[model samples]
Target: MAFSPASYSQNQPVLDALSRCIAACEMCADACLHEDHVKMMVPCIRLDRDCADICRLTAAFIARGSDHAKHVLRECIEICQKCADECGQHQHDHCQQCAAACRACVEACQQYAG
Candidate 1:
């Protein structure tokens, strides 16, 4: 993807980090849905989906070189944090892995959002 940033180099790190976060979120969402207890995994599944969507949009915003990328980054951080908290509640391996991914995404997004 090409981003038309006012200053390209300034946003490169943010763009890269957002891309990783989006990938993680998508993987985690898929993992959660594969869990045996479908009913208990509902919230996790939903949050994972939400987080994935936000991360993707944030990446696209940054890629397009839009000045509004910061706003999406902030929102993505919030969603990642929430998803991490929810996933952290479970003892399953997938949940634990998803939580870690979300936390990483949160930190990365926060750094860029600033």
Candidate 2:
């Protein structure tokens, strides 16, 4: 299914954070793939992808005001934190940016995760 951020007008902060996190995750993954030691970055790449997917789902569910949005948010925050931690271990610019974005996303998702 196709998802559109334009449809989500409320919770602007959360929406924006989620969007940023997705972009960061994608960029981090691509950067990881291009690294000389790609094998060593497998975990970071996996976490980035997982965090991005959960963030996207959380935004969609929240936009729709789904009853399960909180559940998704809970998972999203956890993955965001994990992704940030993983990315923080790397010294690449993409990893650093992704970590920062994921941290911001974690804060944004906290309110709704309750």
Candidate 3:
């Protein structure tokens, strides 16, 4: 699909960041499921799923040059921040990785939002 030069250039970093965040959330969710206290991890798993879905949707919106993408991206930033805060409470490596990803996404999204 052809993208307008302005939209394509503006959204490149947002798309890249969103992709990384999605991958991180998916991986973290899988890891959380594998934890010994899988039942106790229900909330984290849910948030991870939510964050991943938003990131994916945000990327799609930006790619399609949707006018409402900035609004969606703002919401995505909020969700990523919440997910990161939640994931940071864990001691597992997966959660740590997820926290980092969330933080990175937050910064990227903030840049786009500004």
Q: Which candidate tops TM-score?
A: 3
- For candidate 3, write residues 1-114 as lDDT tens digits: 234767677778878888888998999999998899999888889989999999999888778867787888889999999999989999999888898898899999899777
lDDT of 3: 0.88
Measured with C-alpha atoms, the lDDT of residue 83 in candidate 2 is: 98
Deviation from native of the Cα of residue 69 in model 3, angstroms: 0.7
- lDDT for residue 93 in candidate 1, whole number 0-100: 75
Q: Please, what is the TM-score per model?
A: 0.80, 0.90, 0.92
Cα lDDT tens digits, model 2, 2-51, are 23557355467798999999999999999999999999999999999999
Q: Which regions of candidate 3 are displaced past 4 Å?
A: 1-3
Clashing pairs in 1: none
Tens digit of lDDT per residue, candidate 1, span 2-110?
3454657766776676666566667766876777777888888889889878878887887776778777777888898998899899887767877887788787667
Q: lDDT values of the candidates?
A: 0.76, 0.89, 0.88
Ten contiguous residues minimizing lDDT sum, candidate 3: 1-10
Evaluation by lDDT, superior candidate among 1 and 2: 2
- Candidate ranking under lDDT, highest first, comes to 2, 3, 1
